[model samples]
Target chain A: MKGNFYLQGFLTFLKIGLFTIGGGYAMIPLIEREVVERRQWLSKEEFLDLMSLSQMLPGVFAVNFSIYIGHRLRGFRGSLALAAGIVVPSFVIILLIAMFFQAFAGNQVVEAIFKGIRPAVVALIAVPCIQLGRVAHITLATAFFPILVAVIIAIAGVSPVYVIIAVAVGAYCYGRFFKEG
Target chain B: MLFLELFCVFFKIGLFGFGGGYAMLSMIQAEVVTSNHWLTSSQFADIVAISQSTPGPIGINSATYSGYISVVNEGYPAIVGILGSLIATVAVVLPSFLLVLLVLKILNHYREHPLTKTIFAALRPTVVGLLLAAVIVLMTKDNFGSVTDTPWQFCVSVFLFLAAFVGTFFYKVHPIRMIILCGLAGFLLYS
Candidate 1:
């Protein structure tokens, strides 16, 4: 039974590592479904805790979440096992692709794949945008701020680093200079 | 000297990289293109496009590719290119590994604190901003000919953009399917 738990944890991470395309947020619902709903490895509350912990720490949220969940289920060994599970497949695949990238570098089929993937990547990123907005109870004012940031970065030719800094500064100024709180 | 610099830059990026691969873009651009002068802006943008199209995180892919290019251009031995790539890759990932370990140690103590909750709330909106920035940059980049010159391409991009938006938002279709459909569309129309 204990061995079964270890195997389940390994397989869960392996699936996440192998299939997830965009990383992090893209894997959230799938992870939630597998660990919380299907496998019953964690309760909903525990999953939320994991989410919070994953966000608070550095690194990819999905990777951090794996560590947290693995640790919760077992211990240090479990965390290592899960982390390996989440990283190994992508690592191996990326290394292999990088080594042979020149062969298919200009293939028409490859170009087609990328062209298709780009828009989908946009949609993948958008999912969390809409979901997070809903969770945050986005008002017109709050909604406008992020949209404005998006437009500035997308259309106005600003570097994202500066944009992030500007937004941080703007938020600080708004909170400090404008808001009563 | 160059290899050491590469290691340090990627290490910082990996350590502070919040959100994910996209968040690392700004730091990478700043460190590699702006500060180090290791690669030109056009090259950096190309690396980004290639990394996005290929599998794996943008941060790691760019590091490997950049390290390879930088070492080769410098007339270093081929082994140096491999060493540079390894150093950058390991450096970029090291922070996340350590952070996970540290979080494991302290998480039990501060798991339910109000301060922690407030920080998470604050971070959520900021993450949204970061993602928005990525989308904006990709759309507005000048590498693709101007919207005026490639009206068809622009139109196609917009069409796919909306199709994906509606498909995911309303129909709840999986994103992977959307990607596959877009690939098919590109093959039929552009190829």
Candidate 2:
């Protein structure tokens, strides 16, 4: 049974690594579906908790989530297996593509494909923003803060690091200075 | 000296990088542009544009390009250039792998910690901020020319943005499908 569970963990992460596009938050729902809803490996609460941890950690959220989930299902070995499985496909694909990227670097077809992907990427990131915002129970003020940040970064040409710093500081100040606690 | 520096720097990036490619951007910029002076700010920005549009993680793309340029323009040896980029990429990823293994070993002990839960909650909004930053950078790139000169590209970008927003929020389209559709649209429109 343990062996079976380890395999399941490995395969689950493998599938996520293979299919997930746009990375990070875009992969969240699919992950929730597999680990929480379908496999019953974790409860909704546990899954949400894992998500929070994954975010706090420094790496890609998807990869971190895979690690956390895999660890939950099996032991250290399972975690290793799952993390490896998840990354292998993308690592291999990217490596191979990198080798030949220059060949098609200027190809119009390639350019067009990316052009299309760009907007889709925007949509992909945006949808998650809204969904996750809802899940986080963000108030209108909180919601508007991120959108404002987005626009400033997007249209006003602000640096992202500054935005992150500003938000963190803003949130901290609000919590410290304004909160009635 | 330069070659060794590149190698060590990238190796560190590869080793410590936790949140994957996007997360590595700030660090990479800090090291390469701010600290090392290997690349200028504009050059770093240009590399970012290329990395995003290309196939691979931004880390690898940046490493490869930086490696190539470091050698070609600065007379650094090819091996040093390659080694530098490779090292950073590897360094960034190593921590996550090792940490995951360690966490797995100790998983049962901290499964229900409130501190862990609180940290995760705090991180959710931050991730959103990071993603927002990425979108903002891409949209406002000077190459796109103020939405005036490149009206068509601007329009396309806006349309796709709306499409993706609707698909993910209202229609519930999977991201993979969205990626495919966008790829196809690129071929149809740009080709």
Candidate 3:
């Protein structure tokens, strides 16, 4: 099978990993843009599906994400490539920063830029939540559920793992016993 | 012995690191600083600051830095520190790789089962909520500026936030360009 696309995908993960800051949620938009728009590696719904699965798993959200995308498109080796691509940038960047130590410590210019970025990153993250919400079919009737979820998590400070477990179990039991859609 | 300890610590971190990068911060702090005394709490804070300002996941970034710095802190050479970094990064990522493959195997096996489908479908909205929660969690005074205390910064932040939200959400402005623009705006205004 032609695996050239996986190579490009690996490079894409590398770029995304290098450029995208703030981690976790920040990577979501860039990955969505690349995989869904530029690369067409995954459909919108498929991306959301993979994202939800990634969250449920116990690891760094971005790592789990790359692994899923890699496995889906290019099997195990693909997963490895993508995972390394996402990680190597951070590893190198951190090591370099550590070596210099005093030079870049509390660098004002970098801090200012990130101060500007922190809010934009929020926007960057919020926009996709909305778009993916649509993809997830969160409509009027079911809107309350997601709102409750947001409240439980954001306000009450509940961990997302519990939310995932409860929802999955509820849906599974309901679907199995009641034959509901 | 140090390398072995680093490997074991990071592997455990990876295994239990749920929800996302920020969620793992406390666990990492406990292991590296509180438990192992590999680094000081302030040093760990510096790692966090560096990690936040740089690219990649926080957990992986912390692991890499902790591995190298912990070794160097022990008076090892920088070359040895590099090995420490490599070992920590790999160990942290290893569990995730193995776990993801396991889940994929099961999901692929039950690819056609309705119950699995139901569970998968039910998760979609929850993911939405979780993403929203991420934004909310991040929308602290630290990121957005406190509206009451830091009025000017707060107003400018609100503008930037709206501008970014509108620019991307409505006009289809690419996020990379948006990021650069915001960075420039921030430098010019704040600096």
Q: Which has the greatest DockQ?
A: 3
The alpha-carbon deviation from the true structure for residue A82 of candidate 3, after best TM-score superposition, in angstroms, is 6.9
How would you encode candidate 1's per-residue C-alpha lDDT over A1-181 as one tens digit per residue? 8878777788887887677665566678888899899999899999998887777765656667787888788876787677667766655565455445434646887665555445555555566577766776778778876677566655564555555455446655555555635
Task: Go through the candidates in order and give each one's DockQ.
Answer: 0.30, 0.25, 0.41
lDDT of 3 by residue, A30-60 (tens): 9999889997878999999888778766678
What's the residue-level lDDT of B130 in candidate 1?
58
Taking the tens digit of each residue's C-alpha lDDT, what string does model 2 give over B31-98?
Answer: 67556667654355445544554433355556656655544346555445445545544554556667
What is the TM-score (0 to 1) of candidate 3? 0.63
Chain B TM-score, all predictions listed: 0.67, 0.55, 0.58
lDDT of candidate 1 over B94-137, digit per residue (tens):
67667766655676686565544554555556656656655544
The RMSD (Cα, Å) of candidate 2 is: 6.6
Worst 10 residues of 3 chain A by lDDT: A102-111
Once fitted onto the true fold, the runs of candidate 2 whose alpha carbons sit more than 4 angstroms away are A1-56, A65-82, A144-181, B1-89, B98-119, B141-146
- Evaluated on CA atoms against the true complex, candidate 1 attains a DockQ of 0.30
Q: Indicate the worst ten consecutive residues by lDDT in candidate 2 chain A.
A: A94-103
Order of candidate numbers by TM-score, starting with the best: 1, 3, 2
**What's the true lDDT of residue B125 in model 3?**
78
